[model samples]
Target chain A: MAAIAKSSFRKTKTKNAVLPYLYLLPAFLIMGVITFYPLIYQVIISFTNFETTHLLLGLKSPDLRFIGLQNYIDIFTAALPVENFNFFRVLEFNFWWALSNVILHVPAGVLIATLLNAEGLWFKRIYRAVYILPVVVPPLVVATVWTNIFDERYGAMNQLLTNISAAFLGNADPIYIRWFEDVKPPIPGFLPGAPLTLAYYAMMVANFWLGWPFMSVVATGALQSIPKDLYEAASIDGATPVQQFWGITVPLLRPAMIPAAVYGFTLSFNLFNFVFFMSGGGPARSTELLVTFAYNLVRNLRWYGVAAAFAVIIFGVALIVFLITNRITRATQNYMEA
Target chain B: MAVNPQSTKNMFVRIMNINTSGQTAGRSLPLWKQLVFQLIALIILASVMFPIMYIVTLSFSSITTRPSKLELFPKEISFVAYRQVLDRPTGNPVTFIELLRNSFMLSMGVGAAALVIAVTAAYAFSRFKFKMREVLMILVFIPLLMPAVGLSTPLYLLLNQVQVKECKSGETAILPFTECSDGGKGKLQFNLRDSLLGVGIAMTASALPFAVWNLKGYLDTIPRELEEAAAIDGADANQTFWQIVIPLAVPQLAVTFFLGFIGHWQEFVLTWLFLSQPKDYTLAMTLYNMTGQYANSIPWNRFAAMAVIVALPVAIVYIGLQKQIVGGLTTGGVKG
Candidate 1:
């Protein structure tokens, strides 16, 4: 069949303008009601003393006080009735938590992916399959399971420790490691006010189990994207495997892993479930994440206004995070611009 | 690791086909290094499998009490735990079937709702050159940056306001329930935020940004020339979009839907926060309820079985669609 003549069958610009909005109308409706409207409402409630009593009529409740940023002021100055809670300490701990997760997960991911990426590795398929299992399990399950695993008595961690001692040091008694209940920081003064307790270490172990496979999966995808001929060329150029890794593999993996690390950082920073479910922000609220703390304000204390204020503060921090990470990883950059 | 797990890979390179290499030193590790890698892999595998094996083992055990002994494997194969878990997951009146149904409905509902709205928005962003396009895109995605739990307070309050009052008006809808906001008084009927529907709405709100972004990326990759060709054949914009573009986007639509499905299925925070009724309980919530009890009161085997029930569907779905999900996942990170 002969090619048809090219024609301007598309709608006029003025008419077409409405078309895009029409496409977006439903999205905006849902998002507006659920996201933006609530966001604005959250901002509004942050200024008032909204609590459980206000749940019925919201700000319209006659008893609700318009506190005029008193909640924010109270939070910043630690004037809230909540115990052992410091705003800046949670912020500092949040950053440290995210940074530490990235510090551990990224390198370990790269290394594991590199090892698994090696040609002719036996049972590599099985290994990859096994490692990916953790990724599939829900975080709720992971958190609950890990909490039990770190249980002082029936926990597998203490049991494993007990077994190790029995084999090497002739002590058959069960070891009790109060991973969640321990209050004292293992390394005191390391993070200043935000003490990193034994629970933090246990959390790191659980999250490590939770976090690495994803990075490894990301790294593996990046590894395959790397030109095999680059490795072949490096081999011919007398570059050792170590040198090849440092030179070709690491640099190429950067584009992929950098974005992933930033994503991981943000995720770990906001990780509410693991922190909340594992320790309940406990052992004197040492391992609390910002989100978890904000949640606790509403859940346990019924301090809705303070929780709103805390949430707004979190939004600001998240904005800063988005900006910094946008600069570093360009994760949200549009397709054309990138 | 409370992650949605949208990032594991096997798209272009099948796991079985990972080592398609000639016997050359350039690719393969040395004999000793291979052994070392295997050893390390085994250690990691064992550590990773420890919790999973423990859960599976305990689920199959007849004992209901928490095992103090270091038992990693199933000594006896029994379905008592499963039977108990299925019969009654918690002390709450909810049955396992209701839990599963709630989980299925919330996840599938949010997944479908998000997909329908997201695909259109993604298409507009992909194909149109309009003012505030970038602004609107950023506006929609701003929520994605904020921790979802942070937004829960407002959502809870907002949706909570939309309640049904059991008034003389025969179950009237009320915002802020002002006793019908008239002279007559009405009892508070249904709090929207305190039900599965309200939680579903919230999840959809949270689920939208990611779905829109992911689908938009896919839509952008689809060429305009196909639509142009259809246009030359006398097709209008909607016709072309429906006939040409949507069919093309089917695979990606599935990808976005399943990705969100996995997360929503496992979601406990919103449902746990919003719903108080035992009948509205999801599998995740029931499982959570079982764990918060004292160790002595807790039935360990039943808890393990509940966990398996909650985890199995998601695990199966992830493994089945690992390649497509991870591929869609990597394209975003790598491209960005």
Candidate 2:
């Protein structure tokens, strides 16, 4: 009787252990087939000369040859005969783009949030509601809209510029600035080969409109969580409002702001849609990012092997960036860890 | 002092006036500061609204091939663009209505499918602990770090391999099935490359990871007491999950669905990469194609009309759920 009872208890334990696995099966299957498999598949195909010939039969094609890191070597050595291509230049631009955006966005966000949180500020809700408009509009739409706005002939931007010039200099000759097509870098020698072109500045303005509202929103959320009594106490201790903002508020908001800034950096780094749709890496590939260049290899050139290797390189770069940011900010960590 | 009652009343009035003035002085911006703040606010608002306002106004403007001046507002407002949007000037096979239906169906399907799979998985992650739990959780989030555009090439290849062709002639078919004799004389191939459903599946690969992470975060916050109570009353795991947990997760489900739907609706990459057939074109693809070689050739007003139309649903959903969307965004900073 004792032996039988022990066996039955073991049976129940086994059944209980199986339940979680059963629950996880569906999610793992979907993710494994669609996401994980493709990721691994990409890695495998990157080593081989995979292109249109092998697309039909895939790995089964005997014609599929293993090239053994030739793709990687080609990309790094700049051996590929593609126009307007340089790996290092694109990487530098991508980093600078993300960094510049964060530098602008985070402070602007905190300042705006502080202003909105000011005593007796009217229409706070309206300001927030309207500000979030840019955040909701898809990046593709934003890109197109901004492109149209920057159109040389009928674009609102040039027209506005022309009007301002007309008022000041007495020349209304419809100032048609080649916003997208201008390859000349306004500020030269700052970045290696990747000059900050007029198109770059135009993109910055467009992305600034797209990017800042999100940081402000995050900052606003963080600001609200700070207790009101702290401000009162600061005031009681004879701290000026500006002093209180710096001494108390900024420190307290750091926990939220750091992570937000990191996230913002990552976002602007891999901002594919806005860059792709707006510029198409135009005017001599001056504005091309790593992701966009990788995509161009596939889309325009149909160099599958080279594109795959480029993608893998992008992944490695992204991972390194993520790790560095995580170390600095601990963005992914729980609050308890901090 | 007792004799002078009028002086006592005057003192009381003076004290009340001092209190009112002091209260007003505590929390008001100075006149110049106020002016500066208002000016800055209005300028930013105008700049932010410029493109949107341009499109909104342009949709109402008359269709102009060449405009000598950049007009902020139309001299004559007309609905010619809207009518043209409905009419087929471009010789595309799919009509506007058909494209709308396909887009709507595809987005909704992806939303529902992602939610269904994701909820169960999120519930597991939230409630149950299994072997390799940490490892699996990392796997779920791994896709979030990688650039989505990177995966398109491989997914295009993988999706093409499973192309099931109906063997009618058997000569053209890659894999000829000898069993089916009742089918049409000409061969039929159901390649995943050309279908919208296939595109949704590809989209779900990206959407699933995000949904799982977000929903899991939400589910983690939900107290387990309800489930414990249900279990104490002799309810099974499935019963507890279905009756208690799912109903509680409704708001999150809605958020997940709409977020996924909005993204899939605007998805251009996979559709552009995979779908060659014009019949499978989404609004995004059509809009992209409209920006073809001749920017001048494309009707400005009609394009603006399409832009407004595409933006409308997303805008409505966003406005309606601003609070929740904001909440989701900050927490799930992982992009959809």
Candidate 3:
């Protein structure tokens, strides 16, 4: 009986030890092959002068030589002979794009959410559902639609502008604003590569349309969590609506909003689909972001080594950004904080 | 338990006061202020809907001439562009139906794989305490944080090198191959590039992280009591999990799957990178290919129709799953 009990206990212990690992196996295996392997592979490839010639042979090829940090140096120093390939410019534009998007989106989102959160607001649900159109429509479609809307002769945007100019300026020759093709920066010397151009504004308009609804949805959720009694109490105390809004609502919404803002910033930072499909990082690549430029290096230029190195840099930048934001917002600090 | 008429009356009066207070506050806002707010909202809505409206109108119009002016309301509607989209008699060999089929297959395969992989992993994270769990959880989420395109280079290369072993029988190669063709024996290697299966696998990598994160948060909320009860009833852990937790997790799993499906349906960048064959062209890739270096190569009307076609499934899925999506997004933030 003692031996039997001991054997059963040992069996259960072994099972217990193995159960979680069993559950985790499938996911870890898939992620290992696809995610982890590629990341490690990218790091290795980044260190080598891997190109199209080494494509067929892969790593086992004798001609595939390891060149340390040269790819990174070429990218940063603008030594690559690709057209308008400057790293700092792309980096600067990426930062500016994300920052400006957040700046525009957060306030608009809050205001809209607050309005929609009104006590007697009619069709609020309808408004929210309609606004969610942008969120549902993929970036590729959104970019394509917006691109056509901004077309020089055939676009509605220029037509709208033309009508406005006709109404106001009495000039009806059609104000054909070259939205995507204009290389000249609307604001010179603002970004490192003088990155803020008319195309940037066009993107701002298009992305603002795409971005704000998400923020509003997030803000709306946060707003709903705020107790109704807080407003009633403030009102009972003879506080103005503005006062109550600023004092009660703003402070209450911060914890949620800060993390959301960080998320929004991160998303826009690496918004490859929109920037790629919409602008193609054109107008002399002034609007090219780090990710898009890296993609272009592969797709158009086929500079595999440099592109891999660029990807590594992007990964590093993403990690740093995530860490900084996480530190600031404590977004991932649940365990530590607790 | 004492019935107090006085207390009840006081509560009634307080409720009345609250209602009146709300009413008065609503009335106190100047008429112009409300009007201005509504006006701004309408204008914003108009602007938001402008591109959509343009696309819709353009899709309805004839392709004889591109409209010179803004035509929000179509004067004469035609289905010519839709016909063109449906029957591609021109540049690409792949038809619209084929594109739809490819997109559907790739996205569905990706969605199912992501769901299956994420569900088990999420269950483990939510239910168990183990070594390296936190580290592994962080590892799972790390991919979500980085731009997916950043890793596309290595995947592009890796997928390019994947070779399925083909066995040689007689003079012909028998393709139910069991071994690696790397040894230069009586075997041939078939590279998996430009294949739907390869693209689907690549897409699953991008979709898995969020699926795991969202599902884990949801599973965390499901009470452990049921599983515990099942354990008490002599059911093993696996039995308890399969019977109780999976059924409970179905709704969330559906939500995750739909979200992924909608995303993968419209994914083009990876498809563009991995696939060179026209047969594997997704609807998104096909739509993207409509535009050329010069703007007028593809007619505007046909492009609009194609955009509509590409966006339709996504729109339907989103509208159908709006509540779940909104719920998921809001909750997903703090936890994710």
Instruction: Show where candidate 2 strays beyond 4 Å.
Output: A1-9, A331-338, B1-26, B89-91, B166-188, B292-294, B334-336
- DockQ of each two-chain model: 0.52, 0.28, 0.36
- Which residue runs does candidate 3 get wrong by more than 4 Å? A1-6, A121-126, A331-338, B1-30, B163-190, B292-294, B330-336
Docking class of 1: medium
| TM (B chain), model 2 | 0.85
Task: Kindly report the root-mean-square deviation of model 2 from the true structure over all alpha carbons.
Answer: 8.3
When only the first chain is scored, the TM-scores of the models are 0.92, 0.92, 0.93
Q: Residue-wise lDDT of candidate 2 within B1-336, one digit each (tens)? A: 002223344443321111112233345777777777777777778888878877877888876574455566666679998778877624586788877887888888989888998888898889987788898888898887778788877777788765565655554444323324445434447778678877888888888888899899999999999999998897878898899999999998999899888888887777888888888788877777655234577788877878777777787776665557666765576432
Off by over 4 Å in 1: A1-11, A331-338, B1-17, B20-30, B168-173, B176-185, B292-295, B330-336
Mind giving the per-residue lDDT tens digits that candidate 3 earns over B1-336?
A: 112234344433321112222342443445666676677777767877788888888999886466689888777689998998899923689887888899999998899899998888898899988899999998998888667778788888888876655445424332323433443445444557668988898888878888999999999999999999998898887898899999998989999998888879888778888888888898888777765344477887888889998888887777666656766765575444
What tens digits encode model 3's per-residue C-alpha lDDT throughout A169-281?
99988888898898888778777645587888988999999989878877876787787789989989999999999999898787767777887888789888778877888
Instruction: Indicate the worst ten consecutive residues by lDDT in candidate 2 chain A.
Output: A328-337
Ranking by lDDT: 1, 3, 2
Task: Kindly indicate the candidate among 1 and 3 with the higher lDDT.
Answer: 1
List the global CA lDDT of all models.
0.83, 0.78, 0.79
Q: After superposition, how far is residue A58 of candidate 2 from its true place, in Å?
A: 1.7
Q: Could you give candidate 1's per-residue lDDT for residues B1-336 as a string of tens digits?
A: 012232344442353235434444545567998898889999999998999999899889998767787788999999999998888777888788998999999999999999998889989989988889999998977888777788889998888888877777665756653455354657767789888899999998878988888888999888889999998897877998899999999988987888888988888778878898999989887777767334457788888888898888888777777767766776654333
Best by the lDDT measure: 1
Where is model 3 chain B poorest over a 10-residue stretch in terms of lDDT? B12-21
